[model samples]
Target: MSYDPRRPGEDKSQRAQTRERDDAQVEKAHRPDALILHEIIRREGEEEMRRTALALSLSGFSAGLTMGFSLIVPGVLKGHLPHEPWADLIVSMGYSIGFLIVVLGRQQLFTENTVTPILPLLTERTSGAFLRVVRLWSIVLVANIVATIVIASVLAHTDAFKPEVREAFAEISRHTIEDPFWTTVIKAVFAGWLIALMVWILPATGSAAPFIIILMTWLVSMCGLAHIVAGSVDAYYLVATGEIDLAKYVTGFFVPTLLGNVVGGVTLVSVLNFGQVAPDMEGQDRVGV
Candidate 1:
């Protein structure tokens, strides 16, 4: 039954229905907005920035070591599978394993810093803040590369893996480094964008974080996108085994991919994300004017 606006009170059933609808609307409205997510990730970035250099270095190394599994698993899959179209699809799933390990373990992966450290810089806009971000990026990127070198050397010299697996690894490495310099750089930009996007989404995803990490990384692999950290493992493995010279690895693979990733993450993802949220943040700062 409808009630007149002038009535002192509505019918009991109608009033209860209205209250329930109002409560539901309020609950929906209070759910986290984009600005809220931005703040959550920014706070996390601040916390990470506060950690010591040694701590960051160790964690970055561990992340690099862990990322090795992305290559190893795909190698194993390719080793076991017949030379068929479907094999590539199955092998790409292995690319996500290392990412899952690093992300869930909370280790410092360099690509992640492309988004995280930049958040603080965006907020502070100071020379010191910029330098701190540079320091973190330098430490993490170098540590990741060092770990890749160590692991690639071990894999190259030791008989730890099966012969078939080693062959598969070589095949994967060759395929990765064979891309033209400019092509690799272009692909790496996409890889960087996807990885940075993954970091931005994680805090909001909660329990689904693992699936998000896997899906994004899997796309990176399937699409043949270059990623600086994971690609380092593939590129350096070839170097360790004398398949590619140091100059080729540095000029052909490393430098271009590094520049591409930085451009993609910093320019494409972080800057755009901040731009989207900055206006609302500024308005929030002013009150009772």
Candidate 2:
């Protein structure tokens, strides 16, 4: 959640003046290479693993509740915009709002954990490490989904939003279930890939972290890709509104998207990113991951 939280912040000018003029120092000042990025995330994963179950669950819940903004913002956009191709494109950009909040706030998002924890699990390759990853995944995913379900119910039943906004929410939620099972699965693959990639690059983004989050998340929405957490808010809203049955929501959206996201995140991003960094990472300090 932090870029070495124990370390104090240093001014860019102060670091440039104080550090020796060397290649290593130069690398430190600029973008971190893939290996450095891996270590940074791996340490983050280690720190996450050390968190108590309650802390992880609460953070995950907060992320899920906040993720509702992605749906609400886009719905608000749609309510204001005339229905047109270009308008949809502009509305998709609003989908980044929730992601900006979650990522910037350092909340426990399930998609992010797909890559962050796996680096250490790959290096250790021990039963304990594998169990730890599973534990984190289970806790975070459940907490996120439950929170989404609760928020969806609140949106569906309450008069908290304008009628136009609520209608827009229902209209957008329908698209998530309109896709066939395999089609949704395929779309979710790209969603998972991009999200994990966002986490991977974040450690190197310096002050551009917010821009990167918005850009990558916008790509997902613009491409109509499925994301487990973000899409859940939409899908669950339909179920709560009685527009779709629970069985259809689960079979059509939940199952396919979940499988696709896990496959895309763990296989495409986590395994491959670690594979590229493995040779350089060998025999290095364990760093207690």
Candidate 3:
């Protein structure tokens, strides 16, 4: 008979302990293979992109209407701070209200999600995925802009808003129009970057996400950075009141801002995320392993 590996009447506790240690060591040495991280990011990007597009379309419309508060609040506050120029800044803080709601509540806001969903398509061979992502983005973005224009126009024409408040809205629009197209793009890029940063950081913070969002957006607004969706509120108001022509608003502000925002989110945040995980994945053979 072969020699027994275990002694009769022995507790076998040491053997159990040795086996556990071996298992623990194996687990500790196991690193995630590169392809897994790539696939995960890819799937996350595509799914998020599609879902985010829909969410953004709806959220953008709401943001458009809600962002009207940005225009209204500053002017409203200005009335109270009647004597101080700094009051203008104070009221702008109110503009962040809609953003905080949309971001924290998990509604897609367009610009931020632009970066996240494109990565998979960029790296994958999935058929129609790229087209679908683009199609969704185009649909949602156009709808959002149109909704903002219509809503802002209606509000501007009606007595629903007080005269000074309307004037403030118009004033904001005029200021935007005064900027060069390139300048607007630059501002939008900065805004998009900040928004993406907010998104990336929020996921890491469980309970304090809301506070982070509020703080980042407040800074975005206070810095006068232009956001494509949010800026549409001001732009639409301008177009609605005939203060700026439709062509100029579209070409000058909307298009450039959209491009800038895309660049900021995709080129900056998404790439950074990809880079962070790339180094840890080298030399791992792409096996079913």
Give all candidates' CA lDDT scores.
0.89, 0.90, 0.70
lDDT of 3: 0.70
Displacement of the residue 86 alpha carbon in candidate 2, Å: 1.4
Task: Give the per-residue lDDT of model 3 (tens digit) for 1-289.
Answer: 8744454564779767766777899876675443454555466567766565566577557655665565666656654567567776677677777777766555556775665566665555376877776766676677667766776777678887677767766776665566788888888888888887776655455678777877888787788888887778778788878777889888988888888888888777767766765554433335423
Of the two candidates 1 and 2, the one with more favorable lDDT, higher being better, is: 2
Root-mean-square deviation per candidate: 3.7, 7.4, 7.5
TM-score of each: 0.90, 0.89, 0.76
Model 2 worst lDDT run, 10 consecutive residues: 1-10
lDDT of 2 at 177: 86
Q: In model 2, what lDDT does residue 50 have? A: 88
Off by over 4 Å in 2: 1-25, 283-289
Q: Which pairs clash in the backbone of model 1?
A: none
RMSD to native, candidate 3: 7.5
**Number of backbone collisions per candidate:** 0, 0, 0
Residue 113, model 3: Cα distance from true site in angstroms: 1.7
Model 2 per-residue lDDT tens digits across residues 1-289 = 6433122476776566455455467777786789988889999999999899999999999999999998999999999899888999888999999999999998999999999899889988999999999999999999999999988988899888889999999988888888999999999899999999999999888899999999999999999999999999999999999888999889999999998888888899999989898876664546633
